[model samples]
Target: MPQNDRHKEREIPIEFDFYNTLESLPVDNRCTIIMISCGSTTVKINEHIQTVTAPAVLCISQYDNFQCLERTHLSAKVFHFDPWYIKACLNFENLDDSVPIDKQYVYDRNMLYMFTKHHGYFQGIFNLTPQQYIRLNELMLMIGAETYAQSDDYWTCRIRRMLRQALNCIYDIYVDQCKLNFYELSENSNPVTICTDYIHANYRNNISLNFLCELVHLNRTTLNQRFKQQLNCTCIEYLLHYRLKISQELLSNTNLKIDDIANQCGFKYGSYFNRQFTKYLGISPSEFRKNPTGYSVKESRGKP
Candidate 1:
């Protein structure tokens, strides 16, 4: 393939799924697409390769099973997760990578390998050796186990958010290591990582640009400029979205009244909450809860 052909090309968004067939095997290089109907699955990849140990998302247009004996010598584990879950975790639509893929691209988004000709920071963290890949796969499964064990939509969302963060880490590694092409990013800075961590830590509080600037060690203008350039949103806009997302979880999981959920999500009045919720989420809290299995919180005897 020409260097251009090897370049990262975006594709149309397609319906993709994940599956595990380690119990069965494919005759080498037989392309197959694993379909995940729901939930996440993890597999070990033991084939060793000389690559750095970090998380990277992979894109698969097809799937194939590798033939391997059921022996301890095998060297790779492939972790499979619902494509929706992956998409839910990444705001791919708004990502500002130089080689931007179309939102409609249906390529497999795996955390395995990247095309060599593709150059960007996203390539850094996710591409890994078989051993390192196996370890990361195990960690993802543990997270999934904790998520399902809780059996609460609240925890599920939390886990989903965590998965998104993990994927973002892969992308961050890509951004962190790759040469700057379009964005005027700092030479040795991962501002998104810093800003997001701060946001999550103080999400429950009434956080603002001035406060976040102090926390992330950047001035308000620089912070605002960089976040908007990279994430496609201002700091405050992202916070509102984050708070609204939390409120949606609260409304669905708990029997808490609208006002209560609003207060808990940092809003002081039910009316303002209702307006914002309706504006962003496209439904009132009451309307959302009316869905067949909206969100029901079963009080856990203990936290997972």
Candidate 2:
């Protein structure tokens, strides 16, 4: 595959390929990034098998480990690149060239760490938002364009840079990176911290007070107490705020319909989402999206 692209002997050995079929791509020591467009289907990556919803990404680094068990209404794009593509692309570090490719992640901190989050076993799936879906799909096209055209002396660099962004975007899709501090928490994290991290990661899911209790191994009263003491709100209230916080961003930034935004934020029903949003922010989502500054003009949001 690398032969198809502009191959300067000095440039890092990386190949780019695009496939429309939902089946797996063969990777010999290379990392394959599979971009599954907006649709739902069941697929097996190694021993892990689950129904993957639309607009998701899967990064696989093993050979002969991917199979499409079911491909109902599936569309995808796949990119294959050498595992050392990033490490070799680096000229700034005076590091040892003899470092083994598999262990190269030890020297590379963040980039590879994202891929090797669960070492040994392959982690092959990441959830993506609709906005993220559009951005990543575009990035794939750009990577293909640069690799095919060999636009300039820096085409490889451009692909590498955008590749980094795409990787980060899909992996960090649900994670609120602002909550990275949660990662520093000890294995025995406090109930509030555990609950907050779970909420942040699964805000779009059908999360509940009982689910939080089971996740943190605490009773409902104690869990609510911990959240109230630390955040001055109950667990459910915190979840609502997090969802609305996400809704606020989507409303202000994207041209998505209010109903679609509400559903994506886990509101089950659009009317309830509308009522709660209006009650909390003292304005309808449509009104807020239209004039975000309207909230400040109101004397009080809680009042009539």
Candidate that would win on TM-score = 2
**Would you give me the overall lDDT of model 2?**
0.67
Tens digit per residue, CA lDDT, model 2, 75-117 = 7777877755666543213223443334655444344434434
- What RMSD does each model have against the real structure? 20.7, 11.1
lDDT of 1 by residue, 113-169 (tens): 231223223212144445544544655555546433554435445555655554544
List where candidate 1 sits over 4 angstroms from the true fold: 1-189, 292-304
Clashes of 1: 39
- With candidate 1 superimposed using the best TM-score fit, by how many Å does residue 181's alpha carbon deviate from the native? 24
Report RMSD for candidate 2. 11.1
Cα deviation of 229, candidate 1, in Å: 2.1
